[model samples]
Target: MGLGLFRMFNCFSSKPREIPIILGSETPPRPKQRQRKEELGGGGESKIGGILGRPYVDINTMYEMKKELGRGQSGVTYLCIERSTGREYACKTIARGKLVRKEEIEDVRREIMILQHLSGQPNIVEFRGAYEDRQNVHVVMELCSGGELFDRIIDKGTYSEREAARLMRQIVTVVHVCHFMGVIHRDLKPENFLLASKGSLAPLKATDFGVSVFIEQESQSHMNPIHRRRRQTEANKACQHTVQQNQRRPRRKALTDINELYRLERELGRGQFGVTYLCTEKATGRQYACKSIARRKVTRKNEMDDVKREIMILQHLTGQPNIVEFKGAYEDRQHVHLVMELCRGGELFDRIIARGSYSEREAASICRQIVNVVHVCHFMGVMHRDLKPENFLLVSRDHNAPLKATDFGLSVFIEEDKVYKEIVGSAYYVAPEVLKRNYGKEIDVWSAGVILYILLSGVPPFWGETEKQIFDAILEGKLDLESAPWPSISAAAKDLIRKMLAYEPKKRITASAALEHPWMKEGGEASDKPIDNAVLSRMKQFRAMNKMKKLALKVIAQNLSEEEIKGLKQMFNNMDTDRSGTITFEELKSGLSRLGSKLSETEIRQLMDAADVDKNGTIDYYEFITATMHRHKLEKEENLYKAFQYFDKDSSGYITRDELRHALTEYQMGDEATIDEVIDDVDTDKDGKINYEEFVAMMRKGTLDNEGVIGKERTR
Candidate 1:
């Protein structure tokens, strides 16, 4: 009844076709598939229909297969012409050998059933029956030769908002029909929808029911009581929602601008999608971290969905221990501001590095907290797709501050029996199954295991010079348990790590089980002995190496020409809001906040201290320029050479201890230990001095050692 369903679905024509003249006439018995093949001089029948439970039907007799259309994980789609009607159609031939598991076979059967059930619906691909033969199952359906929706969109370069709305209406109609028919189309992406024809107004047809399932009451009853209620609630909410895509320029409810409620402060951190800020509530004066995602940045459908999902996840997981508290979400015209708990203690590794060295017991305690987060997340029916040290923050500056999982950008609700195919998360922490493109909630455990490995050994078990190399190492699975720190690590801790890092996702330890492990449990077997000092030294090599690089960047910033520092002058002026020609601590903080930083007060103070070269407690124009210059400027060979020359003041081609001391002292980081550590880390030849090549290498190394080489998120 919606959108004149009979007109929208061309296959549902009211005009009846003339009855076949031969319908009541005597008919010959259908020949067996094998006999037909023999009479046709074809090969013997193969036993591909063992699971289909029906005799094989020779599809070639009815349709002539032509050129291959495309291929999927387990099947190849081909263009075909029906012999009787001489009409074109698509034939998806799935090989029996590819459906190795019983579940896989069942998936094929379920998809056929779903297509059949949805055949007559608007925006759904028409079903032409499934035929199983000797080698494969052939599903013939309507041929959408207009190609994928994504391809068409790409060809069009950009679509008007009206066009996007029209397309979305078709998609939403499909979803609406699916839910009404008691079906769940789990894998809905741009590629899964195809245009019916090449015309501009061609209807879109949904395909790829490989991961779809029927919403059966029996299945809902099988879920755990807690999960059952949550799933039911979510399902009901999804079905009740209606898409108002056709309402052009619809009125929007007034939203409170985040600035009206909260006084935005200094920047905390910046990410791919948006910038985070330190915000204080006006009435209560209570500070919180606000992640303001620009609406423009989230232009894609998936990106907008991710932002909404993250907000929903944060709200759902709020009040859980070890999870960051969600204060509220405020959406304005420009941005969606998510106000969350202000974690002042900073990143997990930052705290650990500050402690210098920690005992095995301490490592166990930290690991326990991380695993507990996993436990809580899984129990709440959430899968935190991205889990790493940076995503974890301490709630306070206390020595034993509780760790809170702060980011849920890539997280999703745990869909029971669904195998996640999206490759996501940080490269170093990604699970083996994730790389294989089939994984579940167990990936969280693998990531936690990687963190524990770093906690114990001071380096990732999968070490490499590049992201690809790191992925190769992860796949290679060569864990170095006999190495330096590992040799000294307690047996019980190693045992726990082994279980958690098991190559098989099924074999890998569950978060609940890991929490119960002797090494992780309270009053457990973790020893109090301090981990090897080499481990701490290794940690510093990666964690604190950025200090020397920062000083070099400061030098480079000084030498930049007017053109090179073009916008910086204006930026500094903006930051010096008071027109004092110098930016005070508060002004700097507020300016960074406006620019979308969520840096804590202490971190902001540290930045101010670093940039205030003369220790005047404020940043002048030039000082602000130095601190704000981006690292990408160092990509220029000339800029690097000039920075190197600044440190090698004597023109000796080598930065000796005296020269290093001078530069570090100028930057207020001239401690003897720091100087030695810098040389030890950067001087590749074990020489006491840094050469031109060595300096370039040190400056080129990624700030977080092996981190960020794969960017903020690695997705496939």
Candidate 2:
């Protein structure tokens, strides 16, 4: 019976490994080549056969080089094509210099290995192959015809919440995959992300893994010792001097320790502990804000340990949207620098100071984001003990873009059962337990509560004249909800703040639990609206049709006679197949197909949805025309949105005058015109109101008649 069972198992396994049997001759016959006359069927011997085993090309053969695409610290990148295959590739060749250290060389090789392992992933740069010469090592990679995402953000000013969120999701997914494979991309920033050529809003790839590291699970412990010793030595030297002292000292001859001062640019900001500067990555000219902390001043061993721990924590907390990305940490003799994504909008503190104060709803929106970020951090076993308005940075004006929580200098990692007794965080936001030197992750929750309170009330819940008084007020835990200034504060919000600011750390609500509170979950009731997916999809399709319409309009504008151009508007009006003031998907798709350039249904939908601000079922003539023109303009080059946004100057859902005047002074019909003329000429409505559609129509007509009115094209 046992023999039979074993035989059954073997039979089941054998079926899985089955291969097709080949039944053929025992020995395969080899074909013999004929003489040149027979081979060429021309009665002449060929030399090709004689050269079969010889080298076909010289090793140092030079090909025609094109424009230099970009450059980096160690190498230069060029747009090149293979002579034999005519395939385009990005050739990155390292320069011979001491700056290209042995470790960095190893890093490049490791990057190659990582790229090779992740070659087929959709959001990673595909590595072709590598070549080494006497002086330089050349790495050939996929040429991303689409430009960098950093450029797009700069040109457009900033991304909308939805766009930023979507992009973050893609980035996090890539990071997730990398971490799962034990490969850490030590350098991850906006400059390293590249868009695909096929779609404007397609997923971006995480590139430039030159500083990446891969460690086995078991060997990770062994590697920490070497890193720690290096950190100690660097810390010792940094402590022995100040920035001025270090600057005056003799520079190291070693390229790695030379401190590439040429790369540094203007100082962005400085704090008590560190300074940040806006610097260009030498190779790509991509700008980055490098935040440098002087290790000399951070003399305490525990504090140094905290900094190192923060780096490790950031590496593990890759997918959280609200946290500012931590690109690798670098330690030199003078400073220990932590490079982060440069949020150009600056801090929430600046915005608050500029605006005076945010509305209750706006504050609530920010509070929700704060809660989400803190919750994500706590869930990952890390606590951001310092939660203040200064630490929250606005990435964009769109209320939805995740507010980046920065400054993890005081962060701590704790297990579920572990309790921390270190007193940390700002005095104003510190928890009552923290004053007693008995704190845990709940201290972070309390600090977050303080931020939420300030956001809503524009003041701290507990205020006093001094630090002692503040601690006393915190201990009392009396929530003054009935005060004159707190009239507008909702009961739910007050309840949340009270729970989060509980005197006992154990009684305080956890970040995750606080996120589910009624105040946050149900706060969107005021802005709630049903989403019509079908209508939205149709509108998106209409936007896709804009490309064809735009080209047609441009051709008519440039080539047609005045009389013909004048008649073109009527023709365009008639071309609106749906008669809903806009062209429909079917009409546009059918029309384009006749020109032998048909857009797929998916493409049409994506374009339409991307352009449609309103979830309306149809697009009007002006909307259709503008969308088409914008699509075509973006197709050819960058900064499409910079010009496109001007068309919507009124900040209304559509474009109108008034809207055009807000965008362009030339379109200002004249302040002397009566309201009636404004209604008649610019407003489609007979009710004397000039809507966006009417304004856009008038502006389009005016622009058609004028030339060189708009300023020179600015490349952002």
Candidate 3:
């Protein structure tokens, strides 16, 4: 009977006099919506909703307006029945177009943004989505069929202390989580709360965010200082633009043929859906990576669906600091082009390897950044699903640079308490619950725990000679804090790892909660110490494993579930070329070379020998995957250095104005004044040239692409 039930009263002493009220009080009839200002071409209403200039529709396609739910000054709410689900939802229709005030339009936009921001919260009314057309905007949300808190209260007349107390607690808890997420519910009343279903045990949800606001306030309390600083900066910026503000958005050009707009320098890497390349924009001569996806090659409907899903996800996640910025996407006859931020510093694995010996402090630093990204994703109800060293990218080569999470192909939107049955993600990093086919977003936490274990001990807690054995170890989730590394590592680090790697999903530490763990605290005293030889030796064991054994593990892991092997099958088929269900050495070599891997004869032979598991001349699909899947992150790091070398024409360890001009000449950036301007923006030490670190920061796209901030990194 806690506050989650949304009860109205606590005790007889504190109970208020109930004002008699009917549940569905209809309002006095008003005139119909001022003549339909503009009707879409397809008839009375749009078929679907569209944002900006996208295609839109009227509610009729999927929903039938049954009756009026409620009304406000500028909008009316109706009970809408979805055609497919046959479920009732509250649809709010706001009159827009020429008759609406600009402020009202912005207010509606803000409310929609807030709903989208916290979409899947259990105690918040679910925002299905919004649709817009020429005349009115339609917002679809979960209909609380159980009706209002006030209606229930007035009907019951009064309630006992237990009932009222339980209701109050639920409302307060909802508000607490909202405030924690930066939203301030300006208007809080019993009328705003509703029951999820008809019953005393049902949960209470707070709806109507039209008056709620996201407040930008600086933090002075206990939290991650780094995050606090970011919030403080946001507050300061908000203050600067307290009144009217206008900003021009960048112009994005559409191109059907990618070759006409950009020059492919080299293949970056390939994923299940597409191969990415390092390319230069023909007009600007600026380096960017374009992912080329073959339309015909895509087999499954989900893979095809993922293309649009990934694009939409990237577009929404663009402006976040720890999310790879989306440049834009273009499509032609055969392929789709996804232009994105080119992170030259490479993956987190490469950064760790480059350091050779890493500090616990440094690992914590990277973990903190990763945790920040996880928090952001969770706030938006997004689950990355895959969290591994390879998925995280260092923003720059600088010591204090941030980490960004990329690759949303495997990511999905999840609501609270819902479990996903699909067993996907890399075997080494997957949670035990994932294998069980019953898991929620906490699966991401277990994956992160594996990553943290590798970071601190340089080896995973769950691993074996075979995939089944590895699965056994992960299921056991047994931690050996007394092992070679634990004797040298701190108790705090061991404790946090244990908590995160907890066998039970409920006990596992959440990404948000983990940020406050002792190990992540300022002087919470984990090791600031050096590399322990025992840990290093164990790490070496991982690297020193025979190629054949690793290949065996990869092959077995890929076949765990049917879904896991779908992408591999497609890739294998594509590589087979002759549709023979197997690939020969020549096919392998050609494919590898096109992907930008320079292999000598000796190396190529060694690779062919490793994956020819049956001692056969040609490799089958499973063997092919096992061979190609064993890619090292170091290759990506090598590409980053090649990019730096391209900009450092003289190999002088720094880039000069001439080098910059030469690199960016196509965009009319070769002018002496423009070259100087670019250099001055990134020249941190008041130096006339840009070093590798400064160059990296300058190259980071999106919010951090600000010239003034890059110049101030070390100068101030």
Candidate 4:
């Protein structure tokens, strides 16, 4: 069987003695394999190894545990088959000896609660069921025969660029969903990510919420000051132990702490928050970094506040697509710990350092995702006061998901109309306003713009030997856009960066607005320009529709006199065909025909084209009235010109069509039919020509109807 087929079997066999070795399966030979797997397990075996030996879990009876699958710090995960359903499952069991403290039990329970709440999330690992027996708490999850992402990375070395982008996109989407719902996965790393298959398209799942917390909304009750202090006390101890352990341990070997049994792997890295270990989940034989905070580090008041605030911020920012997720937070006597989603692809900063720099397109793609994340935070009234390259970590090479934004140490909460006074963040990317201690979330935008500038140019816009010089350079707000390296940057990108790094906070473009910027447009294209004609037409249509609707309502409300009502009804009747009280397009066309203005067979199309803003064909009463008024305006203008022409009897200036026709009929020059035909023919250029030139000529004394007198006189 494949490695995936053997994953569940490893969970049920935790003890070093009890581990079932499969001859034909892909199990590694004892010593050589242990060295390779031990790094992921960190330095403790107590958490993973003892889980299988728990007396409460009847692994033999409940599940026919097969080959060992993987391990972790706290439990062993096995590939087991349910006899009744014959369904496959990955079962995790906590060993007895490893359960040294009450907090460990609480951590397990907390994970169960979190998983229950997150049951509907498809991207999250599916929780099957949990059982409590005499010896252990047995938690079962879906068997993703795909195995750990860490191993895949190892097998493949490094992923292709497309693969990395695809993975980042998927992971970011998952993180976004979690943030929307107010859940934060504080610990995000590679081993926490499990692949559902070995294929490139395999689904990635974020698991291990051993230290996650759900902050109740609208309540400060859960904010335990003393509890946090105590947690910090524990974290300090954990930090001291970790530092001491590191000093004594040799390179490439596992170290063990007396407090915990899990073998610690080499240190991945250290941060102000805590140290991360590449340890294995011994029970399941899975590798994961168990990030532990030493009790010595978090003892300060400010440090504890940072911890709590980070949790709060993560909880509030539940749906952001790019932020890293917090799996869970817990505490041992020596440490306050957080379990997280592990990204095997490593830090973005590291990648950039190794590769030197990314191309403009690659940089833009990364920046766009970051902008999206910042947008989410700003919309929710939160600020990630510290946004730097170090905080951006890649999940995979497919770029399926965005690089996860980690390290919320310096973040803050800002309510509406509130401004923050904290002077925090790395000196390199810090905005000028932040240095002056007058900054808000827009500072983050400025930092982001600076980062984008760096990504594209391989250097930041403002740099100095010291913090002060950097601040001065930022305040100067000068960019050498015309300089050698800078000149190559696209105008759109330069424009975006300038807007983002605007010196004045008020003038700085907001995150949502920045997303609409030309640089961020899909495929790096510019946004669509405005259509002037559409705008003007839409405005006129809106005003006319509103006015007509008001008038129609007033007429129906019995507020008008009967005479006025009759006049309004007449107007309505003129447009309403079939007398159905509603004006249909057919009725309107017929009415126009009576006035010598006939509509085309495509009249419906014309009406729709003129009246429908959203392009739905059917015109309501309001739309009908508005269209009619517009057409009426045109006709009224024509009539006024014709009347003026008729008054000018000489026809040198103007004459109405009526006067010319009358003159022709009276003189017997032409009868009604002939006069009508002549007038119609004379009205050239259409519009019932009654212009001054035509009117004066027609009215000149030349002919009379009775053959007796010829005069320019008005006849009744």
Quick one: best lDDT, which candidate? Answer: 1
lDDT of 3: 0.58
Tens digits of per-residue lDDT for model 2 on 481-550? 7764455556667788889888777688877677677776646422222222332222222112223223
Worst-scoring 10-residue span by lDDT in model 4: 707-716
Evaluate all candidate structures by whole-model CA lDDT and list the values in order. Answer: 0.69, 0.50, 0.58, 0.50
Off by over 4 Å in 1: 1-239, 242-253, 544-643, 646-680, 683-705, 709-716
In the range 425-455, model 1's lDDT, one tens digit per residue, is 7767988777676788888999999999989
**By TM-score: ranked, best first:** 1, 3, 2, 4
Off by over 4 Å in 4: 1-264, 281-288, 353-358, 397-401, 526-716
How high is each candidate's TM-score?
0.51, 0.41, 0.47, 0.40
Model 3: worst 10 consecutive residues (lDDT sum) = 707-716
- Runs in model 3 deviating more than 4 A are 1-255, 522-524, 540-716
Total backbone clashes of model 3? 14
Model 2 residue runs over 4 Å out of place are: 1-262, 397-401, 522-716
Task: Give the Cα-based TM-score of candidate 2 against the true structure.
Answer: 0.41
Quality of model 4 by C-alpha lDDT: 0.50
Scored by lDDT, model 2 comes in at 0.50
Error of 2 at 475 (Å): 1.5
Q: By the TM-score metric, which is better: model 1 or model 2?
A: 1
After TM-score superposition, the amount by which residue 521's alpha carbon in candidate 2 deviates from its true location, in angstroms, is 2.4
